[model samples]
Target: MPARIFKKSWLIKSIFFISAFIILVIGGTTYKKIEDLSQSSALLTQTYKVNVELEKIFSHLKDAETGQRGFIITNDPIYLDPYNVGRENINSSYAELKVLGKDNIALQNNLRELNILIDKRMEYFEKAFRFSSVGNYNDENFKENFYNGKKLMDTIRVKIKGMIDSENELLRKRQQTYESNLKVTPMFLYMVLLLSLVLMFITYSKIIRDLKKIKAANEQLEIFKESTKQSEIIGQQGNWIWDIEESAFTYSDNLYRLLGEEPQSFTPTLDNFLNFVHPEDVEKLQKDVDKMMINEDLPFIYYRIIQKNGTIRHFKACAKLHRNLDGKKQLLGITTDITNEIEHFKTLEERNLELERNNKELSAFNYVASHDLQEPLRKIQTFLSRLEDKESSKLSETGILYIDRIKNAATRMRLLIDDLLQFSRTNKSDKAFELVDINILLENAKQDLAELISEENAIITSNKLPTINVIPFQIQQLFSNLISNSLKYKSKDRIPEIRIVYSKIKASEEPQISNPKKPYYHKITFTDNGIGFDNEYAENIFVLFNRLHNKDEYSGTGIGLSICKKIVENHQGFIFGSGKPNAGATFTIYLPFI
Candidate 1:
């Protein structure tokens, strides 16, 4: 997806560059064409002006010739006036011709020759007029001068016509050039403009396509933004951005809600945000914010903020520096409402204190049971022993039986106290776990109950056990209790055959272990052929002070199995007992493999 976006972006850039290059090329071509056209037009205008000036010069000469002829024919004062005016006009025409043909050597030379011819003709005209004024109307000199003046006038007309023809040729060529330029320029510009339009249309199409994609992307962004907002609200979180370059802040809607205000309730600013901070944390938070500005980063910071309703809540925040493609710097930050976590922590702390007090009281009770409570039981046993030894003969059978009952009660009380103390001490707190061989612990348990096993003539056999991490003493106690329990409940008709089996098994294989915490467990089963009770009392038997039989039927303290349960629990293990009346009982214990 990223690659596709990059490809699209590169394509857009290429199109833009190509379009811009095309436009520049078109502008340059048009400018060059326009410049050529302007020069052609200016040249044509100059050619026409030259032709017009040439025609004006010739017309002025013609006017002077006509005036001279009129004076030679009439010899009147009006004719002299015209002749004088014509001469003056001829001189003015010569001056104008010189100025007009200054840059044309050929035209200037022609004008100079024409000037000589006009001067000769003017001399002939003056001579004729003088002869006529002296009454030499038929004089040969006057006739010859008049004929010479006519020939000179004809030569001047021929020279002026040649100059005019040369100018007309130049004007015709310039007109052809102007017409050719006008025809070719429009076609060239039209083709160029048509190509530019095609390029423009293509560029416009690409731009419109890109715009649609951008619109789609913007819509997706808006959806994602809304999703993020909902997530923040659900998770008790909020986000913000600090544009470091612009010194601007943008807070999410939830951020405003976190501060106990409506979204966009006011302009987001450091001062405005600071107003919601608790008075005690304001200075520390300000310092942290200052550090963030300097470092462009922020570590996890904890502070308290007071809502508008005056409820104080704990908040945790952190931020990192982010730089955009344009190299603008910003700090993206997230803040979480940790008030619930703080409250939970406080509750846990109070519970811990209460637990500590309870443990102290329990320890005091254990001390009393071990020393103070046991002292009287010991005295009672001693007194009963003395009475039985020294005064049993002096008492009646009933009194002796009463003394035996008292001894039994004292012994049971001692057992119950000892069991209770062991159960209390079977807690896991402060207990160091060590890797020990389970076989060794089992052997130790058997050794502790060696005398009882011998009396029962129990056949105890076990399989090899793996080494496991556990509280050693507690596990040893657990094994001893189970072995002793089996022995105490041995069926009178059969010799107790206790089998201790060990194996590694998956928790899933054990149907009794639901929602097992560990993947594997060390399974140790003690099966015995003993006076097993009904299976109905399997769970109840593990309860403290719960007995399946009366004291007369079973010389056992119910506290023993409860202690076994507690010890197994200390090692994060489970124990189950199953039995049938007058049949073998099986006790299974599962300890976590870890």
Candidate 2:
């Protein structure tokens, strides 16, 4: 009899192993087909991206040509802005194309040739601009350059079109491949799944016949019960069931633990569970429970519970009417502890109130600085001026020197007050962004510093700047501050030469920008041949009232760069400074491509 039992067991094990092996094979096959389909779809997406980048390259070229023509016709520097910006955009697009087509040698070769052609075309644009700048539009050289640029543009268009057409053809083939895989995979999976189910059913029938004689079914039930208890503990939750017909309640083991008691420590009843609820919440919870009895359901309800140790916890509960296979109606309910969430919300509310109070204080401080403080400083300056002009002759030489000192002190104070007001204004909440020509802003800034520029004989040169979305006045202020800073720190030995260069750059290409918020940024750098500070103090220089040089050496409040930082931050941009002692400084600002 024992030998016969062993044979029966071996037969059951054999069937189970065979069924599992067949299912594993089917799963493996399905996975392979799915992977193939996914690869095909990814290839199709890559083809589309390549096409898009190619088109973008062509569009940027056209924009450059258009700008060149506009400049040729009117000889306006403003038109050159588009040309400059277009070149930057073209470079950015080409970089993206390189990354996208890194695996395709043909595409890489085409891109290389395309880049060369674009460079030649841009040279033609430069030559044309030079001729146009001198009003030589009708000259032979200008005419030849113009026609050559036109021909080059046409050639570029054909090259881009051909690349795009090639990508489109590749895309078409990939799409067909993807579609074929998509159509075949589902039918294959269905057939495999059907076969797996049949084998599983046969194995299940055999297992069931054997399990009917053993206690394995009861063991499975116990495993399920233990899994449910573990889930409730991990989730900080409890489950319960209510039998409406019998007016009985069944609580899970974790429910007792949730009440700070041992599992199964008390008989689960409606009144018994209510005993743990807080007095303030007990009444409301009783009403909800009563409604559940009548309506056979319970909407989500929030309440507080007091554990045996007197810890008050917030809870949220919900219930739904469910009928068992035995046709017994019960309310299945779950309750979760939400005390942490409630605490967090209260903390946030307090912080919000604190922020509001701080903002109000700042506003008050701004009013005082702009109005009350400036008024007294202005009066002091006015009185000092009167004293210097009228009482100078009657005063002794030492007294005259004292009066001069006071005048200088008062002038510095006035400058400090004005800078403070400007810094405060940078924090204004109402920021209006618009698409403005940065060249115009730069010109305006130069105009504001025209007298100073002329006095110092400082030479300021800049490349054509781009038109970008920015807070117009703020950007103008930023330009003014940077230019003024360079002028203020000019070297004594040589004339100050400040250069402003603009380009569009990818975030990944710039090491200073980590985890960049935008993919592209407009990088504008201010390079100056001034008495620059050490690189160690680069970040500190932008702090309000943080100056490298004493006030006696340099007439500045040190709030200028701070205001520049705030303005750039307000526009979701970044500003960085780098310098070498007694050499020069470069302040680079990156405005996002928004």
Candidate 3:
């Protein structure tokens, strides 16, 4: 190769000059086309304006003539309204049309003749009116004047039509010229465009090959950009750069998104960012900024920012100072949104407060149950025992019945106290949780109530149960109380039947409870075939001292279900019951398997 175009520098310069020349030729062609279009547009607009004015003149004259004839017939002033309006508007319309046609001397003379004819028609109308007023309406002179007025009106109409026809013809010619100009002028532009494309192909043939290298560079940068954004979002962190010299801030995209905003919505300035901070926290943020400014060491700050949605979020930010070779100082920092962490801490705080309040109430209850309430019930039971053992024969039948009633009342009170103590005991027990075998627990419960189960002629059946973490004695007592309830509420016609069903389930599938972190549950349901009460009392049955039946119908301390509720709660579980009137009751308990 003697000489290559790429090696010759002058060839590159020559290509640029050729490209510039091609563009100039195309631009000149476009300009000529635009000039022709502008001239055609002006002519068309003038023609339309002239036509509109001529039509206005014709319409006004016809309206005035109608008013004049109406006045001649009815002689009413109201008929003059159309005539008055036409006379007022026609002069302005004619003046505008005449001025528009001033450039064309031939049309000027024609417009002058049209204006004179319009004036003569109105004069004839006025002359007829004067003649009719002076003489009779049907006089010869008045009839001659009205006839002349009609002839003048016909001449005015013909002249207006002539002007309108001429204007329309001009408009059509201008439109043809405009269309011809667009086609002819763009031909030169197209030729010039083809030449320019050829030159650009020579210029950028290697440039396109080089652009591949640049594109790969850009793709590498994009990988870093995407990775940075992903890391920020996952860690709930965002980076920011503050230019100390310029007092400006460059925020990463995730930083803006973290504030519930789109990137590039507004520039990140100190004051602008502070606007999203809570009012109560703004002072703290401002002071932290000052501290970062003063210290050479990187500063750490924690504060709250209110998001665009009006929700408060907590943030922890730390910044390091950086200096480029150009000696420009900036602060490169990362900020982490800790809203979820803050919310978790707040939840723990609330839970601790509630536990504290419960402890205080339990202590107060324990005090009263141990001391104040137990003394009266104990004395009554002691006196009843003394009368039964030592002086049983002296009392009459009614007295003995009264003593029995009092003794029965005392026994119920004592049982209520014991159950209340048991309910309160579930709150603060020292028993550690261990894996207890449920099959053995149910057996122990049945054995404890052997005499009652035999007397009530009841049948106890249970499916296979799971070994789960629980307080052993408490779970045993839970089964015993529920089984005893079924025995006590049994109908005379049907022998009592108690079914204990246990199964394992995912916590999400269990409708009675939800613990997403702990995914599985051990479900135990104690279903009884006894005298079930109304479903309305389903929730009410778990309340302390809540009873569905009277003592004569069913006897209990009324604290058994409340104790069951407490036991389930201590095990981090749920207890729910459903029943229908005179149907059966199902008591379902959900215990976490974790």
TM-score versus the correct structure, for each prediction: 0.77, 0.57, 0.47
Ordered list by TM-score, greatest first: 1, 2, 3
Instruction: Report, for every candidate in turn, its global Cα lDDT versus the true structure.
Output: 0.85, 0.89, 0.84
Indicate which candidate wins on TM-score.
Answer: 1
Model 3, span 1-594: residue lDDT tens: 112323454666788888998898788878878988898888888888888888888898888988888888888768889998999889888789778988978678888898789788888878877865664787887888888888887787787787778778778888888888867877777888988998999878745654565577678778988998899999989899988888788999889988989986897888899999989989988888888878743577888898889978888899888995457998899999998998999999999999989988978979799778999778878989999888889999998999999998888888878888887777626788889887898999999999999988889889999888889888988999899988888777788899999898888876667544468878888888888878888899999889888877788878999888888888888888988656678999888878
Angstrom error of the Cα, residue 261, model 3: value is 21
> Ten-residue segment with the worst summed lDDT in candidate 1?
1-10
The count of residue-pair clashes in candidate 1 stands at 1
| lDDT accuracy of residue 559 in candidate 2 | 96
For model 3, name the residue pairs that clash.
none
Over 440-518, each residue of candidate 1 has an lDDT whose tens digit, in order, gives 9999999999999999899999989899998898889988999998888888899989999999999998998787889
Ranking by lDDT: 2, 1, 3
Worst 10 residues of 2 by lDDT: 1-10
Query: Candidate 3, after superposition: displacement of residue 503 in Å?
Result: 3.2
Per residue, candidate 2 scores C-alpha lDDT tens digits across 1-594 of: 323434578777877788688778778978898889888888888888888888888888888888888887887788888889999999998999999899888899999999999999989988887888799878999899889988998999899989989888888888988888888888887887788688778768766766664555567777988998899998888999988788888888887878889988999988888899999999899999889888999999999989989999999999999987557999999988888889999999999999989989987998888899889878988887898788878999999898888878878888888898889888647877899999999999999999999999999999999999988999999999999999999999989899999999999999998778999999999999999989999899999999999887888898999999999998888999999888999999999997
Clashing pairs in 1: 491-531
Q: Where does model 3 exceed 4 Å of error?
A: 1-316, 320-331, 334-355, 390-399, 428-431, 505-520, 580-583
